[model samples]
Target: MNVTLRQLRAFVALVRTGSFTAASRHLHVTQSALSGLIKELEHGLDVQLVERSTRRVQLSEIGEAFYPWAAKMLEDLDSALRAIADIKELQTGVVRIAAPQLMACTLLPDMVTAFTRQHGAIKVRLVDCAVEEVLDSVQRGEVDFGIGPERALTAETTARPLFDLPFVAIFPPDHPLARLNRVTWKDALAYPMISLRGEYTRRLSADLQAVHPELMLEPVHEVAFMTTAISMVKAGQGITTALPYGLSIIEQGQLEARVLDGPRISRRFHIFARKNRVLSPAAAGFCDFLVQACLKQDWVRLPEAVSR
Candidate 1:
């Protein structure tokens, strides 16, 4: 029937304490206010919930039957509210993010590890997909946001530039290019280049081409993944180029990495999210954390880490 929470609270307090004075004192409300709430509850429910006397307070038969349900309803509501508060405070929740395969393996894992170290209660999910798929996932609202190269966003999306990572050449220790502290496009082209048959190679070709129209990068081998290209390079197949964000992986492969010069091009990393939507606390916190973390990255610095 239209019973109010305050009325239910007054009824329960009076029944538990067995004294109007004690119930009112427990509720920190005036005795008359407490009595009126119980009366409203009874009127609203059309039942005599309590028998009030100057000496004692007692629940009627129907009131005793409803007590458990009323108490449970209040308890559940309080629990739900507490859960919402916890999510808002970042004490609990999950953050879903989409990233290109390279970043998912390298930069994203580092950022996730750093974030979770501080906010252990929050779980982070990374969807490692192709470059186009990263944008598609974000556009479809499949994840909280996407992190990848800057691209033309749909009207519904927005992007914030996180950092720019320069291209670095990686090769076997004894490779000729490895002898140079810094290599140029011509220096790398002198050797057979092993490259990924992916967006990165395509983007690099376009960027370098813009600087010199006739420049040609004929790879001795093109593979579908960076790791494959890296393996080939480790076998002394040829040198390959990639952004320095994941230099650690190159090091693990026993390959020497050096900054690439000539045109001094770099790829810009951006954080993508829906334009009009609000990010949950965890997602927003992650965006901030990622930006800060990238700023601290040695490779993200320009003119110092690499030629450009």
Candidate 2:
């Protein structure tokens, strides 16, 4: 405890090679500095650590008993330091993310899997949030990043456009458009529609309005979330629209999904990171992986079932 790590290292090297010059070379230090460190350590412990003459040096009684202990202690300390370095250098730390429920189901699971494989020591936390909540969390510094549709974001945050997901029609198997591969917006117009209402905190209804301006999107059944909208479609009550590239649980559970070609209401998936904020090295690497993932255009491919 009274001695420094340098002192212990020098002592170990001197004993291992039984020569001051060899220990100095081993430690990359001058022989005089190494001699001072060894003497300082011996003086602190009040023990005769080394027997020295003009050209020869030998361990004393106390030094003989301590040689193995000092060497082992230094080795253990070095190993611990290397482990901590790996945790930081290898992108091993906790990262929190805010994602929309649809993305939590559609894209994030696979992304998380790949990320964890490469960085097994990193801890990841995923929050199933609305698009507006995701934006708020990222801006407020509660989350490292957010993934959702691109909307009006503050200038402090930088967003990368990931992909464009077109609208898909959701209907029961017995519905008229169920048999079609791709149904036009006019096809949906013929029937009453159900939709997620009050899903976004912002006053702007960006997705629907951006797609259909001239025609009214008569929401016969207004629900609070995507799950509710899917429920309505399953009940044979009315049909709704979803992201063509993204899959809903309703696709496998109770309803059919058809791509809509005419209205072509697609959205830009954006990855949000606060601008000018210093990110931890691990978080920055994770963001890089996210960007590479976005460019690959592989998020839309869904497996047969949800692995949640």
The local distance difference test score of each candidate is 0.83, 0.75
Candidate whose lDDT is highest: 1
- Give the Cα RMSD of candidate 1: 2.4
| TM-score of each model, paired residue for residue | 0.90, 0.72
lDDT of 2 by residue, 1-308 (tens): 39888889999999998899998999999999999999999988989899885367788889899999998998899988887787668647888889887777767778778988999888778988766688899999998888888778788998877676666677877888866655777788689888766644122245446666655566787766676777777777888877754553644546677666565565677888799776766776777787787557543454212211
Could you tell me the lDDT of residue 257 within candidate 2?
A: 72
TM accuracy, model 1: 0.90
User: Which residue pairs of candidate 2 clash?
Assistant: none
Error of 1 at 79 (Å): 0.4
- lDDT per residue, candidate 1, 1-308, as tens digits? 88888988888788778788999999999999998998888898888888665366667789789889888888898899999998888888899999877778877887899899988999999998877688889988999999888788889999999988667888787777756766888788888998877676787788888997777788989887677788788787888888887666666538777777887777788899998888999999999999998888777755345332
RMSD of each: 2.4, 5.6
Q: Which ten residues in a row have the lowest lDDT in candidate 2?
A: 299-308
